[model samples]
Target: MKNHIVTAFRLTIVMLAVVGIYLLIVYGGSKILPTKGNAEIITQNGQKFYANIGQEFKSEKYFHGRPSSVNYNAAGSGGSNKGPSNQEYLEIVQKRIDTLKMEHPGMENTKVPVELVTASGSGLDPDISEEGALYQVKKIAEVRHLSEEKLKELIKNQAEKPFLGILGPSKVNVLKLNIALDQLK
Candidate 1:
């Protein structure tokens, strides 16, 4: 009985030490990050916005990001929790598809990118796939009176390539892209 108690006590002390070390390492690591573990704040047109969090863009002139299940509420990040075949989810997606088609008339024949119609798992994804950004070029060019080729070039410039050139899919940060668009003369 005494030996068992001693072993348990030692185990507890070792676990505590391990946990403390892990926490220290994490805290130290955060300090080296660009934002220092804080949100990446971007100031645009005299207004500050969190670049890391998704923002709702309703205007036809701006490129839209992924759909947010929580409506871009940072305080309540979550998905819709509906399966692919859920009736309500399907209806929501259909509405998005219809809206996209209406907004971009000639795109009826082109397949809509899935990210534009579906909310991300975190409900706060600020980035959209490159294909998603390109999908809206026509409508944005029409509303903003810019050339589609220019907009396409902007997208190509803003796209972040896959890590190490071979890992993840290429994506564009919508907020950054819109800011760049505004900067275009």
Candidate 2:
């Protein structure tokens, strides 16, 4: 009987310690880096999506991100659930291409980034391929009234390298690049 009571006490202590540690991590980290929403993000974010768009959008000097999602309520980000070869996907990509052409009137079709035409698997991707960054250089330079050389420099500086130098392709953090673009603007 005494052993049983002692075991119960030990279990309760362990559970409490774990719960306390979790709470501490949550609260302490949030305090250290407060997450807040701002202009630009039509929808708000929570803990789930680590990419912060609110801050990125507030700046206008950077190249804009891809608009590959259509969330009716922004409940949560999910893919269009369409395969690459789906007719619906083809139609969507065509529309996006049209929009891009209109926005960057002088840009050639070949210059459009693949990411700009294709929706990400998650549809809520916060990054784009490095090609996407290069594709936007001219447009960003024109919009911000900055030189192409300067914009390209920013893109190169803000872009992240491949994981371990070739495990994967290089990527650009859309949010970070946009923020940098804003600063340049």
Candidate 3:
């Protein structure tokens, strides 16, 4: 019994030390990042926006990010957890596809980008695939009265290339892109 008690005490101490080390490593790594582990915030027209989190942009003039299962609630970031074969999930995705077609008119025959219709695994993805952003170009151009070519150019400029130019696909941070869009005269 005494040996077991000592073993348990030693295990507890070791675990505490390990956890402390892990926390220090995470905190130190954050300091090296651009935002220092803090949320990236952007101010536009005096309105503050958290650029790191998913934001709801329902306006036709702005590009939409991935759908949030938690309704953009940072406190509860998560996915819908519905598989592709889930009937209810299918309904939801279909509805989103219908809405996209209605909003983008000429895109009725075009394949809607999957990311645009489905919530990401985290449901708080702030970046969208390049195709996702391009998919909405027509609608945004029409609503904002900007030329499609100009909007495409803006997307190209705002796109973040893959890490090391060989990892992951090129993606556009929706918040950053929209901010640039608003800046356009």
Candidate 4:
């Protein structure tokens, strides 16, 4: 019917308009952000690294980040897809907690920060909660032979506060923190 054809044409035009407007908004928004939505590349010691993506840090002298479901592979960014109630997932987390206990002897009484044991939704998060960084201060200080107070100060300095003062939790970018730690004497 002619009416049906006209209706389909009108709907198609509306859908196209909506999609175009959305894309324009996204492009415009990206222009205001740092690097214009491109990955932030960082250079150190003749090595190039993407500052926005998570990197593995297993040394006791450096802060650790959240576990990666995709093994920190940016090409496969995703969570483990297992809920906390899942026995297998719980066991994995327990193993991590046990490992942390072994690595940091004095932290038996202190609560381990949850973010340290769980993977981010993207599984490539570069930042950790401020509490998570503080939790590892003593261990890092012992290994690095730096004063705990000084290391705490470094964590404080590296912390990125919640956006607009209340939008999200404060976090510390592990890569940046570790780089600064290495530079410390």
Q: Which candidate ranks first by lDDT, i.e. highest?
A: 1
Minimum summed lDDT over a 10-residue window in model 4 is located at 29-38
Give lDDT tens digits, candidate 2, residues 42-67.
22244232354312232334655656
- Model 3: per-residue lDDT, tens digit, 41-66? 89988999898888999899999999
| Per-residue accuracy of model 4 over 1-185 as CA lDDT, tens digit each | 99999999999999999999999999998887657889988799999988899999977878999999999999979998999899999999999998887888899999999988889899999999989999999999999889999999999999988766897889999999999999998
41-148: candidate 1 lDDT, tens digit per residue: 899889999888999999889999998999899998999899988999999999999998988889999999999999999999999988999999999999989999
TM-score of each: 0.86, 0.63, 0.90, 0.94
Candidate 2 residue 10 C-alpha distance from true site, Å: 27
Location of the lowest summed lDDT over 10 successive residues in candidate 2: 34-43
Off by over 4 Å in 1: 1-7, 17-37
lDDT of 4: 0.91
Clashing pairs in model 1, backbone N/Cα/C closer than 3 A? none
Instruction: Supply the TM-score for candidate 2.
Output: 0.63
Task: List the candidates ranked by lDDT, beginning with the highest.
Answer: 1, 3, 4, 2
Q: Which one wins on TM-score?
A: 4
Stretches of model 2 off by over 4 angstroms after superposition: 1-61, 70-75
